[model samples]
Target: MSSPCFPPLEPPALSPETPVPQGPVAPPLPLPSDLSSLAFPLPASSPQAPIPPPPPLPPPPPVGGLAPPHVFGLEKSQLLKEALEKAGPVPGSRDDVKRLLTLQKDRFRSDLWWILFCADLPSLLQEGPQCGLVALWMAGTLLAPPSGIPLERLVQMAMDRGYTAQGEMFSVADMGKLAQEALGCQAELLCGGLGGPNRERVLRHLVSGHPLLIPYDEDFNHEPCKKKGYKAHWAVSTGVLLGTQAVPSLGYSEDPELPGLFHPVPGTPRRPPPPPEEGSPGAVYLLCKQGKSWHYQLWDYDQVQDSNLQLTEFSPERAADGRAYVVPEGGVRAGLCGQALLLSPKDSGR
Candidate 1:
């Protein structure tokens, strides 16, 4: 494959000048099918399988600046280039870029699409337990807030009223309420309350262009953290990639260069890297805004779905230490998560 779409696992810090070597790429590691968290159970496959760690995806360009002139090996269309120009001359400081991307999102090749606005969003915000709030903000960036209520204002109100600055915004109920009241949108929880891993429903939503705000286990995703001190994490499910039955185990393609039925990109050398494993060419992946600084994540389908299952009826560890007469807002003791929240503008009438 022309330069692997992902860098080598745990590779040394790389500069663009480093020459990438050509070798047999390892397949994605088999995550445990067990619905468990950070202190995870082992994978179901035999220990002798040749599964390797997943390839890491690069972070998207700054939203406030110009998008990459070239994506993969294909040159962006003139229309897309013109649109990028409309985002302004600044390379990494365009506030209007989000509005432009929301309008032109469909123009992106599905494989390269996901509403990712990370650490740079709201310069005042920092990555922390506030991931739930950040996920909401990331999703909101793709949607237009109610007239007269700028998205920035809603973010400020959340920081003032929500505990994003103090701690995590892990409460499902409170976050849904925040969406309705702060952003004038409605939030729906798709998988919860003793639900099983349901990729079909999530697939439908992603295909319909409705991204889900999902809860995840930090340890399961291998995110850097203080062991399990704060395990619950939230992210936005921007899009999906699924494999098809055809090809030399090259995997499926959302973008077929023909006038026929949908299929994963064929295993041709011309296509981007195929499924990490030739054995499981039909594997699926979920693209999420894991909110790492300058990084988006490509998670194995079953692993992420199972990750959600592990987060049922979760409660904050510090829900009780508050001053008398002033119960802390984060004192919420219980909440739910399967896929977590499905947010839409109230105007959509979903």
Candidate 2:
């Protein structure tokens, strides 16, 4: 039996003479050797977060930092070739392979980290409530650079091209295809099993140099993330910062007076979170990098008080499975849900 597929988009009946509106082309983002020369620059008026004195250098690298490439069960070349095969060629055009290159100067920059704060695209649903489509649109801008496609045009094209299926939302399963389509060229898109979180797979890809387009279960709270909704949300992982201040260790309580503790619910009067002892561990602060400095900030998505920035104590406890979980200030807990999307070049073979 044939697998069920999303219905193909029906093209509007346009006469041969009908003029097709073209999308605005954006210039490619710059990749420079100097960290200060990032392609996307911070706005001039934006405020910088305060940075505390650097803590002692990070402890020696942890064990099992990453798994061998061999565990992927395929030779590097074979892997890319297979992914390319599954990805197939562009639906209706002939173009060379699309390779998504990074701007990183060194293969290994111990202190360097990557982020997408500078490339922030307001998640406006031009066609519908599809963040996945927004992700593809933004990914295309980063991967293809100089791709000045406007948000409305990108959304319109993606919808018209049938990228959105299944309840008017882009399927996380087909994020790669959307990415390939948006780039208008053959590119490398990778993902972990839809089953659960694969930190190793994600870390391996990050270390390999490509920024990861990770999808978070809005409900999962194990990691410190800024975006929040009751449904799946997508964010890009540009890079990882090596060493930053760790979360202070403090037991959880429902009292509003507790440091690093506040109800994140907007508009509603503040209420204390559940007892930390009963909740799962999560991040209290997200260490964000701007230019050459690392600044600590509360989760941008949740509405915790501005004064609640200082974390009095760092309380991270080990879970039964040997992994350490940090309970957030507000007591929200989430574990790793192993789903992710990787974007790379056709030649990368990762």
Candidate 3:
């Protein structure tokens, strides 16, 4: 085989800057063939000039009168202004003002609801001066009392409104329900407006069976109950009972004579024992009526130790001769036996 054919190579010394020699040659536009024959040399570059020093930064603007405009958004500036305004002082701080306003709003709402409730009462029941008086008393008790409104006046108003005594007995249960409702209103009005503990105290006094109003007597012996010739005022009993429940220590007694009984002996100060050891005789006896027989029960702390410490049973045989029967020899004291006897008047005759 013949050697592979190749294109003719141009000499390296021939370049575009070097013109080809031709006698009296006329100039012509470069043709594709002529361009392909020419080779262009790369231009020589000067050494890179030294980088110039950076220009100095301008000084910060002068300290402010008003802040620079639009640096922060318009909304942000407005927010800051609002914050400053809120932080500014009045008679009270913003929080205090807010609390007072909340209290007022609550009071107004409660008053509106109460008025609406009372308005729904039958016309005959709602009519007369007593109704207006009740409304005023309700306002004073539930909201903050208006200036110069006395508790006695409110009591009198309640009396006038047929809310007081029915026959010889005072309707204490009804009054208690009313008191509870009034306390609820007060709680709504005062919550968050007063200090937490004080608010709680107010709530406790109002809702619980403690007497908010105490009767005063010029002569202690000749009080209203005595003068009225009533057995014991229901209000006094209710208030005492309620107060006892609230203060468990004040209300209950562990005395053997009154064990496991609630609200025993009104106004009697309670004396609780020191905590006892596990197996010690921390028993209390309670006078309880079981069917026709009266029994003295013994309790150990919370549990019943003896259901029948002394059983009081009536026997016509003992009563037939009109002589006291000799008490049987027993585990407990003779005085306890006598106590059992004393408990049942019918048994004593027997």
Candidate 4:
């Protein structure tokens, strides 16, 4: 037994043919160019995970009624309403009457001429005839002579002659005769008769009275209106009377029957007075009849009390001078004077 055990112990001398145990060797990996390229594996995520959208912006604030961010104080609409109310009723509305009344009560008045100029004359005429008449009368008085004669004596004469006198009642022939006698000219010549000595005599008398009527010598070489200028001798009819003078005159015309004498009153109205005060504000009311048509007007003075007047109104027509004077319809009352004394533009040199 001893011999067999010894041989088993030395049986296999250690040799390369013995099996050897080995540790695991990792699988060959691909190398990257940079150190940051190293990657670690991550766990897989769920397929059902959802993404969210961005939040929405707020809306702009309301206007007018609601106070906006920019407007830190009162609402604009309310302020506007308050302002309009303070301004009172709108123009052309019923409330406008109240505004006018208030203005009148406050004494907001204007000049007479300005008022008439701005007024609607047609409306006024339709509303008040007497007012229209008064305005017309005032205009005439202002522009014309003192209603034919001086106030102090005219009333007495009118009363004595009877208020009912009509159509040359005051002896037109006698008046003509008086003029000739006063002028020291024969009646025939003054009345415009044959030529020669009678005409010369009449001419001389007229020159003496009105120096403006004297004929000027061409050799004088002076202006017709110069201080020493010669004038043509002539007679002028002033409605109720005849005037012979050398002073400049207006409203003159020529008629074959009377060469140098003015036969017809240019702008005169044949009527009795209510004379306007001399040097006072007044007007003339002309009631002229062309056939059956009646024309009325108002006039004003450009200077001090004088016979130079301008038309301011007419029925169914307007004045050429852009002036108008009309009374509110039914607004004119009695006892109010209309006529005014007007100065001649020549006299005023305006």
Whole-model lDDT values for every prediction: 0.47, 0.34, 0.25, 0.23
lDDT of 1 at 149: 44
The TM-score, computed over Cα atoms with residue i paired to residue i, of candidate 4 is 0.16
**Which stretches in model 3 have alpha-carbon errors above 4 Å?**
1-149, 165-169, 181-230, 234-350
- Using lDDT as the measure, the top candidate is 1
* RMSD (Cα, Å) of model 1: 26.0
**lDDT per residue, candidate 3, 1-350, as tens digits?**
11012121111221168997778867996656554354643223424334556899998765432222111122446664464355332221112222432444432222111100000000011111122223223233223323424434445544444444311112222233233333222111111111223223322332232222111110232122211111121111011111121224554433343222233344666542222223333221111111111111111211211211222232344347464322324311221211100000111221
- Kindly report which residue stretches of model 2 are placed more than 4 angstroms away from their true locations once superposed: 1-128, 165-168, 184-198, 219-230, 243-338, 347-350
Positional deviation of 12 in candidate 4, in angstroms?
99
Better of 2 and 3 by TM-score: 2
For candidate 2, lDDT tens digit of each residue in 182-271?
A: 554333333332212333343444434454554443324423333322233444543322211222123212223222221123233432
Worst 10 residues of 1 by lDDT: 1-10
Residue range 1-350, candidate 4, lDDT tens digits: 11111110111121279888788989998767774554643223534334345577676544422121111112435664454446432222112222332443332222211111111111011111122122222222323344422222322332343321211111112222222222222222121111222223322222222211111111222111211211111111101112222212433333333233233233543222222232323221111111001111121221201121111122233224354332323211110111111111122221
TM-score of 3: 0.17
Q: Which 10 consecutive residues of model 3 have the lowest summed lDDT?
A: 114-123
* Selected candidate, larger TM-score, 1 vs 2: 1
RMSD of each: 26.0, 26.5, 42.4, 50.0
Instruction: For residue 145, give model 3's deviation from the true position in Å.
Output: 5.7
Model 2 CA lDDT for position 197 = 30
Local error of candidate 1 at residue 100 (angstroms)? 25
lDDT of 2: 0.34
